[model samples]
Target: MTEHKPGGDLTLGGQRVHERLTREEPDLVARVLARIQAEVADYRRLPVEELAGDIARITQQTVRAFARCLREDRDLNAAELRQIGASAVRRAEEGFPLEAVLAAYHVGTREIFAVGSADAGSADVADLLEVADRTLAFVGTVTGAVTRGYLEELRTKIGQEHTARRTLLSVLADGGPVDAVARSAGIALPARYLVLSVELGPHADEATPGIDADIAIRRKLRRFLAAFEHSCGDGVLASLDGPGGLVLLPLAGRLSAVPEWGSLLGTAGRAAGVDVLAAADTAAPSEVREVAGRTGEVLDVLRWFGRPPGLYRLDDVLVEYQLTRPGEARDRLAAVLAPLDAHPELVETLSTYLELDTNRRRTAARLHVHPNTVDYRLRRVRDLTDIDPLHPAGLPRIIAALAARRASLPR
Candidate 1:
């Protein structure tokens, strides 16, 4: 088979088309740009005087390059391709979507064909066809180059932003001075902030067997956290580190004003298949590390206790928080509840009784059992653990032991 070449008849036809196009270059360029501006919404939205000047300059350059390629019978070189690609990068930075930029290219191509056809009325049909084919191929090549450049620039910008955000988060997490870090990050530090620790829930696959799966999970978590931060407004900041992440919420007024934070975080966490645990008190910038440590402690206690998946706060589990601190004390408290392990129902009943403030009727209603059954379970618990639920003196130890037992269970 013979190799195909774009010379001979095609080259001769290209030369003729080139001459004709050059003769009508000014009129054709103006018509093509006008059509693009009329058809593409983004082009129309640009400032009329500035946009027209840019279009005119680009159109002239494109027409001159196309004519030269047809006359010379050569593919566009790297320099020419880079010129077109640079235009795409500018369009992307100016906030034009890829689709819109591509649409403008299509409009320009259509106008070029229309103008070529009208101008070449007396020329051979075969020659016109050859020019049309070559023009279309050139457009495709340029379009591909532009798309690549646009995506490359976009990825570069995203990577830079990610680096900056991670740097700021690291400074904050390390308890660095807020004013300097905030200024560097282009953010304002609030007077008070709440720190949250988020992690994949019990159901999530912690040990997924592959680097790819781990990377995918990290990407998913990042996207979810980004969306959550956006929904929480301007003062919210978040960062991911390995399997867990942190979110810092800046409060303008009292924390009481944002009672919905827990629910909102819960909804976001559940949607992302993660659990969110937060510190109870707001911290100043200087105390960020302290609050962050407390948030981690809360997460540890919740994990050890086998709590259900959801949002948790330090204040909500204060008894467990305190009990889990002294390792020996926690062990002894766990031992206190070990005798009731054989009768798990008794432990459950006792927990419910305490939760309902020692009200047998309320505990029964909550447990969906008879009040007599609740009373019997409480008595059994008291006998097995040597801690009376009704006796005021032993109540604190009993409650602490129960909380420790809950924390010690495997989730």
Candidate 2:
């Protein structure tokens, strides 16, 4: 900003102003007309909306700063002011009406230039005019080159950070030093072993118009995480992204009153519209990394099956029976009823017969068939499957198979 002295003798106080504008303002532009013109040519290539926004924001900030400097009677250098103007030019959004920015430079310059004396200022007048006029011409080229460089640098860094975060989470699952990373990320760990999972949720496939997905997703994560403060005890929260985010909370360690807490918290998650599966690790913070590995199991279930969102213990949902080891236990039992397999109707008959306890009257009543038919299927099963319907081993295998099949059945 140029300041006028109270005395009649004018002095060029060029030390207080920003540099970019000094380069672009007329007193400065005249010296760099060729460069400035080339820059303006490049500005024309940018979209009008982008340019306009840039111009509005940049001018607003610069004008405000210039006004302050002038009011303060600051003695800024003329060269610095021109550089400030040029810097503002760089920030102008596409189609930012370079003319308006150039005009603003003049508006700001006139305010400060008045402080100087005709004798002293006239000496630098030619140089100032040259810098200002040329700023309009070369601003576009300088700004574009600078912007491209910045964008490349920003994108590279963002990619590196995202990949690093993912890798850290994976290693954390395998007993890596997660506490240090957690602290750096601003996560606090303490009592309260709880579960958290990230989900793409219902809108995964839906495209929202006029919304930048990255921005929207981040906003959503912030909102969701805030809700947990009241819902769980203290601990570090790291994102295990997918559908639901996994949060490892330290247990309060007084496990006396609420043994059924897993189900309790799970129910709350369901009500909140977040499907979360948690496995409780011990209360110790040192045990957290090991617990993180078990998170994969929760993730698997989250992916493979639709478990009702309710507090659930990992132990409670145990796989009590196996479908794969059919020959080892279940099949040995099944072999007793080999004849039953050969008799196509034996399965139905056995089910009905068991219900009726093989009583002819009850079997007939339940099957809606004659007693003779019931007896016939039973005999055929005994012949083919190699065991009588009344065999003790046969009953246990049948019960076990029913239980196994029930669980494997898709709901």
Index of the highest-lDDT prediction? 1
Task: Give per-residue CA lDDT, model 2, range 1-411, as digits (tens).
Answer: 655332112123343233333433444333232233345565446566654565444444443444344434443345534545455435443224545445444443443333222223556564455333333333343344334544444556556655555554554545566677656655554543544333435333124787776665555445455545445543334573434556654455433235545544444444444444554434345555655555445444433333444444445444422331334664454344444444546667776676555576798788788988888877776666555666666654554443333333345
User: lDDT per prediction?
Assistant: 0.73, 0.47
Task: List TM-score per model, in order.
Answer: 0.73, 0.36
lDDT of 1 by residue, 1-411 (tens): 644444233423234556666888989888888898889988888887756776677777778777778778887888988888888888777767988888877788777666656645454566667777877988898789789989988998778766666666677778676678678767777777777787754324545665466666776576557656656565676776655667777765434455766666766666666665544456787887787888888887776555666667887888778888858888889899898989879878887787778898998999999999998887888888888887888888887787777666666
Give the per-residue Cα lDDT of candidate 1 at 4.
46
Error of 1 at 368 (Å): 21
Q: What residue runs in model 1 are displaced by over 4 Å at the alpha carbon?
A: 1-15, 120-123, 187-194, 202-223, 233-236, 241-243, 249-256, 273-286, 327-411
lDDT of 1 at 192: 78
